[model samples]
Target: MSSSHDTHAAHDAATSHGAHAEKKSMRLMLHVWRQRDPSAEGKFVTYKLDDVSPDMSFLEMLDVLNERLIAGGDEAIAFDHDCREGICGACSLTINGQPHGFESETTTCQIHMRRFEDGQTIYIEPFRANAFPVVKDLVVDRGAFDRIIAAGGFITARAGSAPDANALPVPQVAADAAMDAAACIGCGACVAACKNASAMLFVSAKVSHLALLPQGQAERNSRVLAMVEQMDKEGFGNCTNESECEAACPKGISVSNIARLNREYLRALASSD
Candidate 1:
C-alpha cells in the first residue's frame, strides 16, 4: 500500500476538510476494537498517532494511521466506510461509548478531530448487537438490517411514468412525519446503545415512513407484520419503552415512530384475524 495522498490513497472515499486552517497537531491514543473475523475473539488494541491534523474526519485520521501501518509492514485496521458522507451510515463506529461520539446529530464520518482534546484517549469499537456480529476490527455484519428491509420494505405498486406532483394530495402533517422517518440510514447505532439491543427504533422508522404515505397503503398491513417478524427472527430484542434508541440515533428519529409501529402492528393483527 502507498500513502493516503496524491493518487495512491489508502481510502480515497474517506474525506477531511480545511487541512490548512487552524493547523494544530493532535496526538491521540486510540484503543480500537480488533477482531480477525466473526469467530475470532475481539480486543482493544492501542495505537498512538501524533501530529494528526485537527481538520481530519475521524475516518481520515484512521486512514493516516493505516498508511503508517502499511509503511511499517504491519496490518492495517479494517473498518467499514463508503461515501464518507453521513447519508450512507456506512461509517458506523462507537466512539467513547457513544454511538457516534458525544456530538449531537452527527455520524462517525462527520466527527472531526477538533471535537476532542489534543492528547485524549479515544475508544473506537464496532456497533454491538447479537444480529450484527463482528466481521473485523471496527466492522460488523449489519446484514440483518438488509434482511428485514428485504422481507417487506417496499411497495409492489408499479407505475409506467412519473406521476404529477399534484396528483396525490397528502396532508402536510403526514408528509412531514414520513419525511422524518425516511431520514433513517440504518446505521444500527440505536441497537448498539440499547441495553436490550432493540431495533424497534430502526424498524419503526422504516415502518412509519411508508405507513404515513398513501403510496405505501397497498401493502401497509403486511409490511408491518413481515418486517416486525423478520426483526424478531433476527434476534433483536423487544423494545422496553426505553428512549435510549432515539437518544443514540444519529438521525434523531423519534420514538413516536415506535408508537406508530406498534399501532400498525396491532392493526395488521386485527385485520388478519
Candidate 2:
C-alpha cells in the first residue's frame, strides 16, 4: 500500500479506538419508572449507562437513554421540556425526593450531570400533586394552574394603542415587589414539594404580583377572592404553615405572599357586603 493510504488507515484506527474508549468510560445507573400510560401500572426499571459525559445536562442524559431505547425497538421514556433554559417551567421532575434536584433557584432543565457522582443511581419522578394528574411517565397535566389563572389573575386591558409604560410612575418598592412575584414560572415545584400539596405559594405569587401594581388595582378585590376560591375548588389542600413550599420553590417566592393573599381575601369579603 502507498504511504499516504497507510497513514490515513492509521488515523482512522486511532480515531475509532478513541471513540470506543470514550464510550467505555461512561458509567451510571438510572432507575426510571416505566408507565405506558396514565391508566397503566408503573414500576421502576433499571438501566446501566456507560460513557455518559458529566457535562451533559440531566435532560440530555435522558435523551441519550431514549435514543438507546428507540434503537433497541423499545418505548422511550416520556418527560416534558420547553426552552430548556429554566424559563419556560415546562421541564418538571422530582430528583431524589427534591424538586429540580441539585440546582438552586433553577428548574429541572437546567440541572447538569456534574451534580451527580459516577456510578450513582438516580431516581426521577414526575411532580406529584392531586390537581396535577399524571399524563405519562414524568409528565403531568398542569392545566389546573391555567384554570386558576383564568379565574381572575390578569388585567382586563384590551389590545389597542398601548399606554406608555412610565405613564403611571409606580413606586420602586412596589414595582420591585411586583417583579419578584412575577418571577414565578408556574412549574408547580411549590405544589409538589408541599406536604399537603397546597397551591398557596403558586396562587399567591400570581395574586400578589398584580395586587401590588397600579394596573392590577381595579380588580384587586375581585381578583384575590376569585383566584383563591378557584384554587380551593381545584381540590388543593390548604396551607398548614409548613414552609416546604418556600424551600422547594425554584423561584424562591416568599411565603409572605400567601399572607398577603389571605389579607386581601379578608378585605374583599369585608367590603363586599
Local distance difference test, each candidate:
0.87, 0.83
Which segments of model 1 are wrong by more than 4 Å? 1-22
lDDT of 1: 0.87
For candidate 1, the per-residue lDDT at 250 reads: 83
In model 1, the Cα lDDT at residue 27 comes to 99
lDDT score at residue 17, model 1, on the 0-100 scale: 28
Error of 1 at 183 (Å): 0.5
Cα shift from native, residue 19, model 2 (Å): 23
In candidate 1, where is summed lDDT lowest over 10 consecutive residues?
A: 1-10
Our tally of clashes for model 2 stands at: 3
Per-residue lDDT of model 1, residues 1-273, tens digit only: 122343423233233323433456899999999888889988999999988876578899999999999999988999888967678889788999998888877888877776788899999988889999998888889999999999986687666698888988899999999999999999999899899999999999999999999999999999999999999999998899989989888899999999999999999999953
Question: With candidate 1 superimposed using the best TM-score fit, by how many Å does residue 227's alpha carbon deviate from the native?
Answer: 0.4
